[model samples]
Target: MTAGASYHGQPVIKAPVWTWQIPWYFFTGGVAGASAGLGYLCELRGDDALARRAWAAAMAGICVSPALLIADLGRPQRFLNMLRMFKVTSPMSVGTWILQGSAASTAIAAAHAWFGLFPRLARVAAPAAALLGLPLSTYTAALVTNTAVPVWHEARRTLPFVFGAGAGLSAGAAALIGADPATAAPARRLALGGAAMELATTTLMHRGLGEHGRPYSQGRCKHFDQAASGFLAVGSALLAARGSRSRTAAAAGGVLLLAGAVSTRWSVFAAGRQSAADPHAVIDPQRAGIARGERIGGARTEPVARDAAAPAGPAS
Candidate 1:
């Protein structure tokens, strides 16, 4: 089967309604979640300056993430509807509550750093933000994979790690850019580990996808994925050499890691969209299921009259 082939005389797949806003939301939200946790780690290490910088990054991400989500929803009012009720089975609903908690706690932490207003509350708020951050960093993977898209669904087991690693890379890059060398050492280590994890999980995801992974490795999607991989590799190398090199090199490495993180989110979004638009990508799985004696919903076990020359009276 080819990308353009039809199934049962009709297109087996339809294009996804999601747009660029979704990918941006995923990237920013992941960054915010990881940055919040990184800030708490810095605080625990007694690095107030670096902690403040990480909190600032989290604040920035918190501000942008909602706007991206609203834009993708295509109506400012629709976001309110999402908060009307919570469903445990719905990743989006759970994510909405998580984002709310993360944003409020992060905002309070940022306030204490930026002003003397919440000095006493900072200890509690900061830790709470970090706790919420754990879920925020990984829930987007659940949200994406919960959909009907074949590639996203098939890669479900590995997507969370991929997204979490990307989030760590983004947060570490933000810290490296904003903090001093001594304070930035943790960030460098995080970038190194995140780069390695991202590379490994991405490889595993694609391999697990089998033929369904073709969309990710072909055309424009391939370019984005390759670029992300290259950037991550170079950034990791530069970060490793930071002790022997100038801060300028370290900063450049951070920037590259940020680029790679954003590109990776974009690549995943595009590949999922492409997979949804290809008929073969949707049909082949069901065909395999049928071959294995699995009863596919809405599928006929017997040939239709139109497909057969005559209908059999009865089966022996």
Candidate 2:
């Protein structure tokens, strides 16, 4: 154990204030962003039926996402206040605008695709939505990682990919519902690829986190992680084997993938909170850096002795 590391054995950082809604928002935002991109790809391929379904799913996700975010803030006005100014340096600021743009662009594209209105606008909006979707889908990873949280900051390299994969999995799964065999192939491929990538990236994140990954591997977070992996694995297998031929199989696989997406977000969020609640999660890493003779914040790691002239404080 490092000397002078503990402060009454208490956590140095406060746990995140975000609640259940944030994870749901993350899941839905990812779905909305990925679905828009998938829809545009389907449109380019002249698969209007599949494109419409993807856009519709994007619309549904974007619509639900804001409500979840607003609910988390505990006031619609607080959410609106975020739109008052844009800060390129702030992940939260950029993410808020991305969500807003995604909501509008997706709604417009879905309307045109579904109701056959404003073809010219959709031609412009569809590709725009797809472009914005890339950032929208993965920006939440930046938001969480920008904080002092050990688990999130340490796994920053791969968490975006994890979130992106979860988004693709959920979006593709949603599109697979009620789609015919011929038109469902693309969605099935998307879902399968997403599930595989999600599993791989999540593993990579945990491995990369090293000692800081305990929150992900132990206790309640471990269960969430296991559920995510199991669901993605089973769902992908089911989709790969029979999804193309059977609508029922496709729908079932899609449902599992959606569940996996939710579990992925929940696991990541919970792990970050758990890490924050554990003081050692912060201290040990710094101590390890000091042991390596690394300078932290340009300050020497050597302990400083108290001055002889200093006055003593009363004990608590």
Candidate 3:
């Protein structure tokens, strides 16, 4: 099938209705989740100051996350309504609870570290928040892949890792914004590690996507993807060279890392939208499957037509 071939040349699927707020929500939610997880690890290592800053970063990200989600939803109540169910099969339902639990636990942990409150609750909440953070960082990948969007669905296996890397990068960058060079050492390491992982996983994801990945490399979508990679690379380089010795370098690198992470989310979201809008994104994949003798939708490769005037044959 050619690109122009479809049901009368219309899109095979509707483009997503999501807007700018969704990408922002993804970025912040990722930062919150990664920060919580990193904070717990730092606490276990007895790096109290670094852990405190991490919790604070988690608090800040969580605060922005819900507001962005609510804005996208057009109402605060709609966000709350998602928590009404805990369906195991639904990514959105599971993610909603993860966000809620992460927010509450981070808040408790942050309060204890910053204001000296809730000492007993903080111990349990801290670990709980860290545990929830892993899914919270990458569940958006599952949510999008669960849909019919060709680009997203094709990259499902690696998207979570890419998202997790972005989360770590952004959280580390946010943490680097404050504190001395010595205190920011761990954050720098996290950011650099995330940048490397993101670069590797993203390359593999695009390679695995084959023709379905066109949106990420063509038109305006290409620019966003390039910017994401560029920012992360430059940020990581700067951090490695001077982040441990200079606060100024660390802060600037941190800003670039955040920009890179945000751009990564935006590029992925835009690519999915573009793929959904293109008919060939859906048609070409199925046609290839048919060529490979793979049954589509568990049905036969050839269409079966019945004659209304003739007697119907018995079921096989």
Candidate 4:
């Protein structure tokens, strides 16, 4: 099978039904997760002011994430149904639980930071929230790769790191806004590291996919992907020079980093949709697998059909 060939010249696999809401949900959840970790680190370092700011960022993301998820679910009521079941095998179930726990923990940490209430309990809650943030940051990548979509599934190993880097960039950028230069230094360094990691992983993922990555480099997705890489590169460079330059330069870099993070997610989603819409993207892998003698049952076993066409005798 090739991209030019299709069933009745139509796509074999349907494009994913997900919309912007899902990507936004991913972005917000990721930011929330990273912010929680950043806040915890600040607290451990005894920078209460910086920690409060970081927690505020986490709170902002937490407030918006559920709305995005519910909007993606199409009905607010459907969101409740997600909690009605708990299945270990289902990523969605696991994600729902993670989100619920993260929300509660983050809320407590944020409250403690702002009001100074629950001083005894806050100590426990802050670190717990940060611990929960670890999985919260990377689980969305698992959710994406677990789907049947070829582009996402093929990059399963790399996507988690990519998303983690993106989350770090977002959280760091958020932390830098309105923060003192001295306090923001750590965030700037973190964002720089994130940009570097994102670039490296993205390059490896593209090379790993080879021809299968065409959709990401072509058409609309191509523009977004290129833009994301460019912005991240420039932003990280500017941030690296923050010591020599004014705070304005670093702030601009932060904004650009955030843009790059958003663009990266959007591009991935768009590329996956393109891959799913192309019939050959789904069939070619199976054909290649069959050629390599991989087991494909039922209608997918083309070699079985070929062998069945051979002439046979009935005597034996």
Candidate 5:
């Protein structure tokens, strides 16, 4: 709200710039995402302690950040206004409710983990919340996808997958660093899952975005994202093979994964800004569409719809 206090160093634009809450939303997503894997692993091993800590950290995150989100809202009071306009189509409302449910379910699971009054009940809550947490993590990514930000809005097809993978890795790192595993098997497992997802997602996103991936490839965001992608791959491989039995390898893997996750988030934020800061990403495509509009893959206007049309074709 300060005069020309927008975008820091980036160029001014016609549309409203992203808010701080956008990035905070990214963090909560990671917490929620990682919690799910941790919970699943816990349930698999019957290690209630790990599961409880994971859920507690995750739930605590979900509970606290929604309040932060409200505060970050341009109209703070308008935050609760979401409940009034619950649209299945709106990521904001969907995410809001997901956070609420995720928070409540996580709390219930944490209680079960702590109290030990009913094993059967807790078992149900853990998997249920874990399932929800996966989507809860990247609901914000979907929110960004629906936006008009040149790169982000268009990259909607792959953004959720990218962020979701980051969330999974973050959760793995948190468990590894925050908890001392007897054999580091859990940490290694998480690293492998996170690494594989991150690499695959990045590859697909780049291919899908094509020229749109320019900012991501060349800008500050690119540096961090590239590093994350590399670290994730290397660290995951090392952790998977070497750390299964080595305590120090697990510790190192935790550090690597944390660094990778940090870079991943920072890169995404920077890429969104860069993509919007310049007109080349947005205007050129549309302008050129005027003279010689070749709808490669799909039209410039209806990428999502065209993508949807693919499955429809087969179904019909």
Candidate 6:
């Protein structure tokens, strides 16, 4: 009935339309993580202005992430409620707190950049921000991998590295796709690295999950997402492997990587919702596993409780 919205009958999915929060999380996480890595690379290359801008972007990304999460939730106040319980086993909580740390580092990095520009205030924020950004970039990966969702949760082995690669690629794309030669070199390298990382991680992620892979690997969404990701990975690798660098190629490659990253997020989000929607995803495998275990002979089971044991025990 609305101008832009489709009637899917109360938000259920013929295919997944996972809200903007999913993309926001993907983009913001990549931006923040990539910015942090870019800042470090800037320091190594001795480009202070670019370094400063990267930090500012990191701050911006961090600041926006929590707001997006709150907005996505039907009840905003529930986000605050996460702090009430301390559950290390819960990545949701860990991710929320990581955002806090990321924000603080971003602020410090900005201050450092400002001071480096001023020269007189160099002692204040630079060193601290530089130190913090490293962890900030990496922890975002841990945050995603710790979830219970099969596609995401099972990606624990390689998710952090994949995320890191995406972040680095995004940072490179933002900094280097322009005409300036100074930012271009580092940007190019970062993009190549990102492309490689994502490709490898994606391959590993898919290979790692065999028959349990319907969520991301099946359906119409998968066709676009998988191809998009594969193309980006290949394009980036080609750019990386080439002896002579082409700006046009680099730009296009970066765009491909960015597109791939977006699709990766979309696929992941849709898949998770799908996984949750079907009870068979949870029930069927579990029942089968239980049946298999029950068939095993001579396995000593745990003792029954006092109530169940009473009948097994002597009367009275």
Q: Rate the local accuracy (lDDT) of all candidates.
A: 0.85, 0.89, 0.88, 0.83, 0.71, 0.63
State residue 74's C-alpha deviation in candidate 4, in Å.
Answer: 2.8
Instruction: Compute the lDDT for candidate 1.
Output: 0.85
Model 3 segments more than 4 A misplaced = 74-76, 296-316
Once superposed on the true structure, which residue ranges of model 6 sit more than 4 Å away at CA? 1-18, 77-87, 114-148, 234-249, 291-316
Error of 6 at 143 (Å): 4.4
What does the lDDT come to for candidate 5? 0.71
Candidate number that wins on TM-score, 1 or 2: 2
Q: How would you encode candidate 3's per-residue C-alpha lDDT over 1-316 as one tens digit per residue?
A: 2654578878979988888988888898999999998898988988888888889899998899878888887566767788778987888888888898999999998898788899999999999888888899999999888899999999999999999999998888888986688977788889999988888998899999988899998876788899999999899899999999898999999999999998889899999889999888898888778778775344454544577875644334
Among all windows of 10 consecutive residues in model 3, the one with the lowest summed lDDT is 295-304
For candidate 4, give the lDDT of residue 110: 90
In model 1, the number of clashes is: 0
Candidate 4's C-alpha lDDT? 0.83
Residue 211, model 5: lDDT of 66
lDDT, candidate 6, 83-148, per-residue tens? 777677776676666666666656666666765453444444445445545555556556655655
lDDT of 4 at 152: 88
lDDT of 4 by residue, 1-316 (tens): 2655558867777788888988777788888999999999988888888789889999999889888888877577768999889887787789889889889889989999989877787788888889888788888889888888888889999988988989988888878776777767778777888888888888887888766787887887899899999999888887787722566877788888988988888888888898888778887887778778884433532233235666643322
Q: How many residue pairs clash per model? A: 0, 0, 0, 0, 1, 0
Question: Which ranges in model 4 have alpha carbons more than 4 Å from their true place?
Answer: 1-5, 243-245, 300-316
Residue pairs with colliding backbones in model 6 are: none
Encode model 1's per-residue lDDT on 35-105: one tens digit a residue.
99998998899887888888899999999998888888867776799989999889999999999999999
- Sort the candidates on lDDT, descending order: 2, 3, 1, 4, 5, 6
Candidate 5 lDDT over residue span 72-114, tens digit each: 7778877768788678788888888877777767777767776
Alpha carbon deviation, residue 199, candidate 4 (Å): 1.0
TM-score of each: 0.91, 0.92, 0.92, 0.91, 0.79, 0.74
Return the candidate ranking by TM-score, descending. Answer: 3, 2, 4, 1, 5, 6
Model 5 misplacement above 4 A: 1-16, 19-21, 117-124, 294-316
Question: Residue 144 in candidate 3 has what lDDT?
Answer: 88
Highest lDDT, which number? 2
